[model samples]
Each structure stands twice: as structure tokens, then as C-alpha cells.
Target: MQFICLIYNAEDNGPQPGTDEFGPYMQAYADYTQEVQDAGVMVGGEALQPIATATTVSVRDGKTELMDGPFAETKEQLGGYYILDCKDLDEALKYAAKIPDAKYGRVEVRPVMVFD
Candidate 1:
């Protein structure tokens, strides 16, 4: 089975670049990634650009519409994600808890749906 860990945090929250804690914060993520990879559970993961760089698109009434940034403002924003191969949801949640962001933000673990 596979699970996707959706990482969410406030854009202005957490350690920011040019700050003293930034380097260590990033290192923590690297260490977590390596730990998962070494354990053979990490399928893939990546950090996304800030929400300010996001573009939203929708189609209604046979017309295409584009919106800048997120459709709704929220305290937390989707920052990144990790796809992991795990034995089950229990295992996936275990790994999700290890994510660095889990401390200050949230890591939503959801089982991947397969079509056959």
C-alpha cells in the first residue's frame, strides 16, 4: 500500500530563510528524508514554492477561469508532500509522524487509491 503525506503550514510560520533557525530546520528535513529512504519507505517527496506563486484554474459554464493563489485564505497552506510505500495505514501514519513539519504544522496521511 501507499500513502501520501500532505504537509501544511502557515507560509510565514516556521523557520524562514535568513533566520538563524532556517539552516537547522532544513537540515532536519534532509535527515528525515534520509531516514525514510534508508528504511526503504520513501517513494518520493518535494517542497513546493510558496503559495504566492500558485495559480488556480477552474472551468464553469463552458468557460475557463483562472485565479491567482489559493481559492480561499486559510491559516495553513499546503507546503509539500511525501509519497511512501507502507504496509498499511498504521505504518504510513507512523512515518508521517516523523516528518519534521509534524512538530509545528500538520502531516495528513491518506492511503492512495489504485485503479485497475
Candidate 2:
């Protein structure tokens, strides 16, 4: 089974790490990535830029609309995501909890859909 882990955090709050905190924070992520890779669970993942840089698009009445920011204005934004291959939802949740942002933000785990 494949799951998509949507990471969310406050854009204004920025990353919690400071100059000194960066090393450990990065190390933790590196370690987690390695562990999941060694287990053959990691499919793909990446950190995203701030919502301020996002462009939202919508189509209505055969017309296209473009907005300067994210689709919605919220304190927490869609920061990044991880797609993983796991045994089940429970297993995916376990891995999601290991994400560094899980302590301050949220990690939403959803099953991926497959089409024939």
C-alpha cells in the first residue's frame, strides 16, 4: 500500500530550528530518511517553499483564475509531503509520526488511489 503524508505547519512561524538547531534537525531527518529507505518504505519526499511563493489557479465558466497565494488562507499551510510504501494505514501512521514536524505541526496520512 502507498500513503501520502501531507505535512502542515505555520508559514509565519517558519522552521523551528535556529543556527545551532539546524544541525540536529537535519541529522534527524537524514536518519529517518535512511531508516525508511533501508526498510524499502520510502518512495519520495521533499520540503516545499513557503506559501507566499505559491500560485493558486481555478477554472470556472470556461475561464481561468489565478491567485497570488495558496488556495486557502490559514495559519497552517501545506508545507511538504512524503509518499511511502507501507504495509497498511497503521504502518504509515507510525512513519508519519516520526517526521520532525510532527512535534509542532501535523502530518496527514492518506492512502493513494490506483487506477487501471
Candidate 3:
């Protein structure tokens, strides 16, 4: 089974880039990536830029509407995601726990869908 671990956390509360702690924070993620790759479960993953860079698109009445930033304001924003190949949801969740962000943020584990 394949699943995606969606990481969410406060937008402006994380360590600022170029700050002293930022390097270690990024290193922890790198370590986690390496570990998962070594275990042959890592399919793909990446961190996203802030919501400020996002554009929400919607179609209503056959007209396109573009909105800047995310659609709704929330305490936590989608920070990143990791796709994994696991035997079951339980196994995928275990990897989600290993993510450093899980300490302070929330990780939503969802299964992937395939259609023939």
C-alpha cells in the first residue's frame, strides 16, 4: 500500500531561515529522509513554500477565479508531505511519527488511491 503523510504546522512559528537552529532543524529532516530511503519505503516528498506563495484556483459558473494564498486561514498550514510504500496504514503511521515535525506539528496519514 502507498500512503501520503501530510505535515502541518504553524506558518510563522518555525525556525527562521539562516537562524542558528534552522540548520539543525533541516538536518533532522534530512536524517529522516535518509532513514526512510534506506528502509526502501520512501517514494517521494518535499517541503513547500509558505502559503503566501500559494494561489487558489476555482471554477464556478464556467468562470475561473484566482485567489491569493490559501483558501482558509488556519492555525496550521500544510508544510510538506511524504509518500511512502508500506504494508499497511499502521506501518505508514510509524514513519510519520519519525518525522521531526511530528514533535510539534501534526502529521495526517492518508492512503493513496489507484484506479484501473
Q: Which ranges of candidate 3 are over 4 A from the true structure?
A: none
Error of 2 at 96 (Å): 0.5
Query: In model 2, how large is the Cα lDDT of residue 70?
Result: 94
Ranked candidates, highest lDDT first: 3, 1, 2
Q: Write the per-residue lDDT of candidate 1 for residues 7-115, one digit (tens) a residue.
A: 9999888888999999999999999999999999999999999899999999999999999998768999999999999998998998899898898899999988978
lDDT of model number 2? 0.88
What ranges in model 2 sit over 4 Å off? 14-18
Give residue 18's error in model 1 in angstroms: 1.0
Q: For residue 115, what is the lDDT in candidate 1?
A: 88
Cα-based lDDT for every prediction? 0.92, 0.88, 0.92
C-alpha RMSD for every candidate: 0.9, 1.5, 1.1
Q: Write the per-residue lDDT of candidate 2 for residues 77-115, one digit (tens) a residue.
A: 998898999999999999999998887789999999967
